[model samples]
Target: MRLEPDVILANRLADAAGEVIRPYFRQLTSVEAKPDRSPVTAADTAAEEVMRRILKQDRPADGVIGEELGFERLGAGRIWVLDPIDGTRAFIAGRPIFGTLIALVVDGQPVLGVIDQPISGERWIGQIGSWPSTTLNGRRVQVRPCRALAEAHLATTSPMLFSRSGHAAFARIARASRDTILGGDCHNYAMLASGQLDLVMEEGLKVHDWAALVPVVAGAGGVMTDWRGQPLRLGAMGAVLAAGDARVHAEALERI
Candidate 1:
């Protein structure tokens, strides 16, 4: 079956989201706290709205699960999972590390993904199956090789997002790694796909936060799975572990 149309639509969704987000990046005067205490801004809401509108018009049969918006057509065979502004805290701080995450998940598995950093003009696209390579701005990119966890550079969004046990598990992996970066949100995975980072582990991710990352990381020759070493899907637990090298991932999983 042809996937070009789906790929085209995914890019369009990312483009639309970026346009809506750029204006509100640092111009938002107020940030509202969701009941879950996560931050949301006008940019986040507006971006998701625009993407949803486009999907409604162009791919009415596809489902949508978006941050800043609610689920729609959940039982559809294909769903677009969106996190319009993945790093809201960084965006509100005037940082350009935030990104728009778009993923096309068929059934429960993500088959195509896009990560767009609008301010930096960087976009990574990853699609599974026969078209397996990941690309950054149309150029092919792959993960760097790291044979051992001790040689790996690790990263996570925040230690606070981890539970007591999850934090302890991450702490073990961090202690075993060469270094750890504290923040970058979804951008961390993009960097990993570009060979700039080796591993990223985090907890408390929703489906929209991680769905796009699987294809990106996997297409770059990396492995991304839950702490239990199982593949991520629509209903998997939120703990995430990604490594550019399979051996490093296995070692890290053992530690967890």
Candidate 2:
């Protein structure tokens, strides 16, 4: 099926952002540390600017919250959330796992999402009231049904964000799962939506990091929640778990 209108627009912006990011992936002349100590590159700021311009042109009534430009409150019911380059570190390292993230949040709930992985030529999109799917070079895809934790595949972006207890919790969860993949950033969430991955749990995320993913996972017949099984909210950093099935999410969260 063709993508919904909002999703189609998001995909367009994602592709634009991807185009801006591609040339800078491995060609960065320098990297600077932000006040928060996280690294930023020219690619990050440039891609975000491209996306923001597209959004502002097409959806003037909608507000936007972006990693680079901060937030603009349009006071509209719909807001676009953007992470121009989700895995900048991986991109700078010349890895193929980085991507652009975009989502439309209405009434504080994410209703549409798109993740574009340029190197992989993959695009995953989801909208509320529809099943989430991936378009790999433009082909439909769905999440896998891994019903139990013992047979599930797991992934986390980083283990360092977790405290000693958090790390132990992650280790325990990893031991319970059948397999684990690490370090894919937002790409991992796309993998989950495509059924290639089963679960991803992590802590320490911004709205830009998690918002775009919520609709993608949930719309695909999966679940995305905080550790306590609550729906995720923007502007807060906490535990996040994305699972292919609800039962697997419950089981995995128990271990964490």
Candidate 3:
């Protein structure tokens, strides 16, 4: 299928943000803690600024909510959600797992999403009412079929976000799954959408963190929900569990 206009725009924004991030990918002089103690680097601010500018230029009427700059309500019934570098800690440490995230939210629901890994030169895009697909240098890819949670591979953006109950739930699910991996931020969700990975469970997310991922996973014929099995709506509180297929997601949620 020809890419939808919004999806194309999302990819363009991802590429533009990647251009801003690539030069500093491995050349960070130092990293410091934000007031909240989360890691931050020059790359994050610069890339976000680049994306913000592109959105303002191309969709001047739409609102924008970015991790670094917070929110701008433009009253246009559309919003661009951004996480310029989803794993800044990993990026600053010289890991190639970081990626840029963008989502077009209409009336508080994400309709278009993109995740780009500049170091890997891969982009994943998903839109409402369309099949999710990945592009490695612009070639299409689909998610793999893993129908059972016991057969699925699992990943989490962070292990520490789990509570005692949450951790136990994760452990139970992990024990049932084929394998578990860690620490890819938005990349893990992209992998699940592309069928390279089966499931990713994460807690303590800001809307910016998961908004771009929801459409990407869902468009790939997968399912994404809060732990309660509710559809993932923007601004919802609690953990997120995304799976490559509904059956696998149901089974995994049962174990959790």
Candidate 4:
């Protein structure tokens, strides 16, 4: 399939994001608290501002939805979803696994997506329908097959996101999985796309958090959906389940 303009633009968006984020990585300067009690760094706002400026210049009619700066022109058919840093805690803690996410959604479905790790100098790019495979640092990547949950390797941003009563469901999948990784954010999904990881389950995610990763996993021969097997929508339930194998996805969905 041919590459669309949006796919090419997503690359520029990643480049724009990297410029603002790399300087703040491990600097931890002037961290502020949001109403939700989540930490926000100057890098977050700066990176998103770069995206907004570039998009406003290049795709003036397109909409933008950003984690740090909020939304603008969301009703437009084509909207850019931006998450300057998907793992702020890890970023402030000096981890390079945190990533910048950019997704171009067309009519509520993500048509193009990118996960960029500026400090690590790695990126995973994916586009739905335009290509059936994903690219990691320009190298094509695909997910490996895992037929059962018992053989799966799972990853999540954090297990603590689960409530005390919700632990039972999470524990069931944890027991079935061979290993569970904590706190990799979108980088974990990039690993899943590149065949290094088998599954990732997450909760309390916003559109900017998961939109870019959805196409990355789907294009890499993985299945991504909500716990009940529903398609993820903007501002939908935060629960997300993704697996390299469909059978494993089905198996885990039953437990989630």
User: Using TM-score as the measure, which candidate wins?
Assistant: 1
Task: State the displacement of the C-alpha of residue 143, model 2, in Å, after optimal TM-score superposition.
Answer: 1.6
Candidate 2 clashes between residue pairs 3 or more apart in a chain or in different chains:
132-219, 144-195
Better of 2 and 4 by TM-score: 4
Q: Order of candidates by lDDT, top first?
A: 1, 4, 3, 2
List of clashing residue pairs for candidate 1: none
lDDT of 3 by residue, 1-256 (tens): 2437777688788888888899997798988788889998888988899888888888888899899888898465888899999988889888988888899888778877888889888777777667645454566666788878889999997778788888999999989899999888888988887778998998888888998888888777788889989877666875999988788888988887
lDDT of 2: 0.83
Ranking by TM-score: 1, 4, 3, 2
Per-model CA lDDT versus the true structure? 0.92, 0.83, 0.83, 0.87
User: How would you encode candidate 4's per-residue C-alpha lDDT over 1-256 as one tens digit per residue?
Assistant: 3447777788888898898888777777588999999999999988999989989999999999999998999899888999999899888899899999999888888767899999989999987774465899889999999989989999988888876645677888999899988889899999999999999988778899899988898988888998789987676777889898999999998887
RMSD of each: 1.0, 2.2, 2.0, 1.4
**Poorest lDDT segment (10 consecutive residues) of candidate 2:** 129-138
Which runs in model 4 stand beyond 4 Å of their true positions? 1-3
Q: Candidate 2, residues 150-170: lDDT per residue as tens digits?
A: 999999888887778878888
Model 2 per-residue lDDT at 68 = 82
Model 3 earns a TM-score of 0.93
